[model samples]
Target: MAGLVAALIVGVGLWWSSPVSSGDVHRYVTEAARQQQIALNDGSLVELNVSSDLSVKPTAGERRVTLAAGEAHFAVAHAMARPFIVTAAGVSVLAVGTAFSVRLGETGVEVLVTEGRVEVARDPVDAATSGGGRPKLGVGERTLFYATNP
Candidate 1:
């Protein structure tokens, strides 16, 4: 009975520490006129701006975040095996270990890299109308992606 109790305690401890390891999806939303900060399971940090909506999912191969609306700054943790990716509108930003901000606006999506580097690309379905190119942005660089109508 003592051995069984010890095993159960260990299991519960592991589960509580890494709930996202079970493929859980975490969502965060910021209220209007307010900002919020979120710490991801992988040690990354995100600062969500006012009226922003963000969803985070950790998969076996990568860490993904979807910005449904508003803006957010990402301070990604370094995990070479799993790349960090952020998607907003039709644009995708890929970063291995970087700090960047993505904003979804009325006319387009804007990406600003404050540290490290990131690869910005348009979704394949919108490639034709948006052009084709994977632009790499370094620290202090910024790019604007025009919104496309489906």
Candidate 2:
């Protein structure tokens, strides 16, 4: 019993001290009442709206995020090699160095582009394999994808 307790304490210490790991463990940013801002490892900035939930997964080649609820604004760093992607509902919004906002509503997911351009696709895997050419949205453009649409 003493040995087990010591091992558990060591495990907790390791988990607390390690900020970056080899595995692609997702980091989360959740807001309940007020807006929250977070700076990502790749120089991207995220502004989470009230009652929003966002999970970030950074891999060797890509930066990925999932918008679970509410809305958030993303200002991605300019990196052509590493694309930034946000998955909400069944849609994927892909961008490289752009500013955009994603809002999850009761009926559908809405994507608004304020700067640069973004691509919206039904399947992220297909979007990646197909050169991410499903449908592109430019600045001042937006799209809504209903849950029943895809």
Candidate 3:
């Protein structure tokens, strides 16, 4: 019992000494539709869906956002210091100074590249956990990755 207490104390101390994680994981995020302009801390704009949820900011060096279950249009600010990554289901859209829309649904995922270019990566499984962007998609291109043939 004494050893366990000591270990717990040490773990707590170490955790307190460590820096905070980069991203802020927010679920069930929402706002008005007609407005269609959500501002980021860095002056970027994201027009979200009626009731969409996503996570943002994984590290100080980069701006990462996850499309948990809806669609979002991004008007990204030009920041080479921070690359924007939008992960929806099994697909991830990586952009720097681009604008695009990403949607995640029960069928699959779709990415409509409007402005800049982005990479559309596929997942072997029905869900995605960890992987980098691949298979680049340029402007005016739309790519879809099916989860179960729909």
The sequence of per-residue lDDT tens digits that candidate 2 reaches over residues 26-85 is: 544443545777788899999888777677888777888888888989999988778898
lDDT of 3 by residue, 1-150 (tens): 999999997887544323234337433355333223567777778877765666666467677787776788998888876777787875777777899998887778999988988766764311122224467778899988887643
Clashes by residue pair, model 1: none
Winner on TM-score between 1 and 3 is 1
Give lDDT for model 2. Answer: 0.80
- Against the reference, the lDDT scores of all candidates come to 0.82, 0.80, 0.70
- For every candidate, C-alpha RMSD to the true structure in Å: 9.3, 6.7, 11.8
Q: Rank the candidates by TM-score, best first.
A: 1, 2, 3
Per-candidate TM vs. native?
0.78, 0.78, 0.68
Total clashes, candidate 1? 0
Of 1 and 3, the candidate ahead on lDDT is: 1
Worst 10 residues of 3 by lDDT: 124-133
Residue pairs in steric clash, candidate 2?
none
Model 1 spans > 4 angstroms off: 1-23, 124-133
Q: In angstroms, what RMSD does candidate 3 have relative to the true structure?
A: 11.8
Highest-scoring model, lDDT: 1
Model 2, which residues run further than 4 Å from truth? 1-23, 125-127, 130-132
lDDT accuracy of residue 47 in candidate 1: 92
Better of 2 and 3 by TM-score: 2
